[model samples]
Target: MSASDPRPAAPRAAPALPGVAGNPRRPYVRPMAGWWLRNPYFVRYMAREGTAVFVAAYALILLVGLVRLAQGEAAWNGWLEALRSPLSTILHLVFLAVFVFHTVTWFEVLPKTMPPLLVGGKRVAQSAITAGAIAVAAAASLALFGIVWGLTR
Candidate 1:
């Protein structure tokens, strides 16, 4: 409060500009809320990032199952029963869709995120790289499913 103080005075925040009319020279500030909804690219980016929450939730569910398994038969059976519920089945389907969206979006950006691919002194197309990665993922998923089915049978 006094000039003798070594500390500088606190700076004032800019007044809210809700149409009261202020300085004409002030730079225009874009509204931050719902900006992603206006652009398809940002919408897709947000949705892809949002899928991580579902992935984490699924991982937690699996961790809980592991804990229940370690607790012995009754706890393990209870966890299995919980998963067998209609709600859990529907939730798993929703998770599956979100996971597929996440995977596709991730692969679409793979070319940009990774080094260029070349074969026989020729660069591969981005679409080819995306398609090849998706194809490989699908094949691996199918192979794993087949192995699980064989074991369960």
Candidate 2:
């Protein structure tokens, strides 16, 4: 117990309990393998999350398309032609379905994640909020379609 002592003092021991068991380990409970199958909500949530894989695949496809486009008109045309193949069409259909599922689920969960929204001094229904969001999305999509159509024409 001198100032020159470089070694740290021994740590205080934990107080011994009178009745508590030593080395008490938690019991292992087996997880339910098919828990999601038993509940519709769980299935829906899992499906919603699974759409992320398709979304990522679609993003990569788009990135490849962009890369092809950058290469030249020939490369871009080749990529476009490849997209017209049956396999590509099927994949696109699957991606579209997954995208729709993701979007709908996102809207459904949005209200729960947000604080209660008030309109006209009353709390707005979740359905109303979801509908409004979908409406806005549809409008934006139509606008983009129009612009693209006009440019193509």
Candidate 3:
């Protein structure tokens, strides 16, 4: 090597920590191995899937109701009576929680699956759509509950 070769110095990496050896950009927070389980997205996913269990139970309840209705007025009354039972009430409460979760999550994902909507040369957001759907569901549920309660009374 000649003394006067005039070679350029190599580029240096930034320090990892302000006082550490190398890497300047803040260290990215990588998820742990089982991160999916702990991730908010995954939490929502699990909640969404969990709703299925409640849906199944709700369907079973409906099936029981249908069976009782078919048996006779006495049987139907018995089914109604069972619905008023403590266990049934608890199950319904759980189902209601799951149902709300399912409805919210379902609507939250609706905008993603469907095509975008444009009105007045502006793009409508997914959140807005989800909110609208949720509002509609809530209104419908309340209306139905009121009608049923009115009829029963």
Candidate 4:
């Protein structure tokens, strides 16, 4: 009836199932609980996605340290001292493991996400692409570490 369409409005009722004899009800919805557990692929995908929580936690911890540094040397020292605790060390170890897994999974999916790369009219292998990416990341990390260490010394 509005300015958009010339046809009459369709019925507001839910569409009936084809085999249902009586009046139609809402469409059936499958249970969502434990869906990720049913498939190995889903499990790996969920685990990869779930690592974001730990990433966010570490980011927040660094953010707090920045805030403490801005407050003064005393506050910054307190933050540094807190990070030296046994609990903090254990938490960091766990974060390291999770980060390693997350990085590997992220790199594994990089080839699927990007357009096919043609090398001399042939497509490059995914394993090569993934290994190249990981190598680049490790080299960058090492260079950064060396720079920082040299500066600190």
Count clashing residue pairs per candidate.
0, 0, 4, 0
Better of 1 and 2 by lDDT: 1
Instruction: Give the per-residue lDDT digits (tens) of candidate 4, residues 114-153.
Output: 9999999999999999999989988998999999999999
TM-score of each: 0.81, 0.77, 0.72, 0.81
Ten residues in sequence with the least summed lDDT for candidate 4: 18-27
lDDT of 1: 0.95
lDDT of 2 at 67: 100
* Pairwise lDDT winner, candidates 1 and 3: 1
Q: Compute the lDDT of residue 64 as modeled in candidate 3.
A: 90
Candidate 3 local lDDT, 33-97, one digit each (tens) = 77668779997797798789889878988999999999999999998998899998898888888
Instruction: Please give the TM-score that candidate 1 achieves against the real structure.
Output: 0.81
Residues forming the 10-long window of minimal summed lDDT in candidate 1 = 17-26
**Residue clash pairs of candidate 2:** none
Off by over 4 Å in 4: 1-27
What is the C-alpha lDDT profile of model 2 across 1-153, one tens digit per residue? 888999999999886554456735555666889889988999999999888888888889999999999999999999999999999999888887778778888988989999999989999999999998888877888899999999999
lDDT of each: 0.95, 0.89, 0.87, 0.94
